[model samples]
Target: MRAQRDAPVDSMGAEKCMDQDASPEVHRFQVLVSLMLSSQTKDQVTHAAMTKLRSHGLTVENILDTSDEVLGQLIYPVGFWKKKVGYIKKTCEILKKSYDCDIPPSVQEICKLPGVGPKMAHLCMDIGWRKLTGIGVDTHVHRISNRLGWTGRNTKTPEETRVALESWMPEKIWSETNLLLVGFGQQICLPVRPRCAECLNSALCPYGRNPANRSPKKGSPSKIPTKNGS
Candidate 1:
């Protein structure tokens, strides 16, 4: 539980990368940009890159005016920085020309942006636009869902996991699922060698209940459900 409390996602995730006191439009754009930069990248790295970009003025016009090499350097060390550089530039142009330097207003339009995937689009909608259009399924949510027997390992992709979850889970909890599972994965239910012994669900979770997966560690998770609502 204490471990989960200090997971990087709690403070360094994409949702935490925005400038709270910025102008409304700039704040929304920063939220979208943060999600765009988060894919396949660790939370701390993305947060640092966002800090640099924010310091240099994280606006659509500013990013569009900046050159690729400099932008790459600003967002350096994130996964696929070279490709993200192009995504950022092209998305900024689209925002300026089509949306008038603001984020797209809907999930469908948001997904059309370069380098922005379904996961980013959903997160952008929820955080940038305050719309709970769908669940944002990243690696942590996808893996943890399966490990907890929610998906039965049938879903091969994050998108599939999202669809499966939305098909049954209450719409009200969709937004909470991403953050909860992401932090859980970062701490207790890790991708490899998970600390099942540290999880409250270890005695009940399918994978955690497995003898081989449980570690002889001493800790506890923060009120994780054994099943849907236990």
Candidate 2:
């Protein structure tokens, strides 16, 4: 899996989801917002939305002052843009009044925000606070972990996979698992009709070990809507 994780991972991923030149405080906020917009939205779409928001001023103050109509326009086309407009506005207010314009420092605290879940909270802590509170199990992670049998059983949800993985995975690797597997899932172990033939770990993978499943023929479902919409 590591072999498949090449330069492309660095070129496009969670690392590039924020503006590095911004002040430390604003940068952290940008990371949280980007993660918020990333749900059910592709990286490219989320990146584009962030670019628009930054151009118009992406600070918490600016988002709060902007009307829901204008804010929706800036982040248009992101999955659930209308709902996100409300979440972003409400979350910003909480951050300003409670966190002094910064995101919550703990995963538990972050999850308390409206529209936030365990996945977003964990990712925010990792990317925003540089602390790996837990694995950020998105669709890719959930699907790939199940495919590889890493979760021990067919975990039905991302949250289930999170608990299963954290139960035994090393403490040090908690942070990189999401990044490592997301790129792998995007490239080889795709959610739908995965190219099992090309996977280096196919020999050991449970799904790949099945003779009929290994190298699907053409005309099979090549794509399916995933959490990332890949």
Candidate 3:
């Protein structure tokens, strides 16, 4: 189903969500690292972990050579840091062995690596490798898409939403969709309250300016009993 585009594209819409300036090679490694750190973690947590990983060395060779325990220690504060450290290390080793110490250029190849799911693969392909072959559906994209009436129904999982959007979203938006919605979700269309009155997409959004307005009514206010003697 098409996301209802009720309003004209904003005058400043093209200026939003600028593509990162990093090279393709750098993007790929960064994507892999970010995806690994992002699982069940907040963006702030992932940023901290990636910052530490950078200090330790970010290349595949460096990651492959590093100890799992050391990696885990550096990536702390990310959810399930200990286990993810092991997974990332194992993934690095696989990359080194299978791809000649280089992160593969193809989404298909990247998907074969340990801990690389479709979401991770799509992210790497878009931002990391610059392939722009697919769309990356994260929590923000999935939630905002449905709220924007792009998905036609409330989807419980990112994968389901991905398949649904991929079928209808034009190929031109394959790469930039996630980034746009991410910035939008973070700044305007928040999970709560949402500041809808000030939102640029309010006119086009099916969920409209205030999701709270649609919530089930509270019935009637309860009155408290008062003592007769005062």
Q: Model 3 segments beyond 4 Å from truth?
A: 1-27, 209-211, 214-230
TM-score of each model, paired residue for residue: 0.91, 0.90, 0.74
Candidate 2 per-residue lDDT, tens place, 46-66, comes to 888888998999999989999
Query: Candidate 2 at residue 56, lDDT?
Result: 94
Model 2 clashing residue pairs (backbone): none
Steric collisions counted per model:
0, 0, 2
Candidate 3 C-alpha lDDT tens digits along 43-65: 66676667677666677777777
By descending lDDT, how would the candidates be arranged?
A: 1, 2, 3
- Scored by lDDT, model 1 comes in at 0.86
lDDT of each: 0.86, 0.85, 0.66
Which has the greatest TM-score?
Answer: 1
Model 3 lDDT on a 0 to 1 scale? 0.66
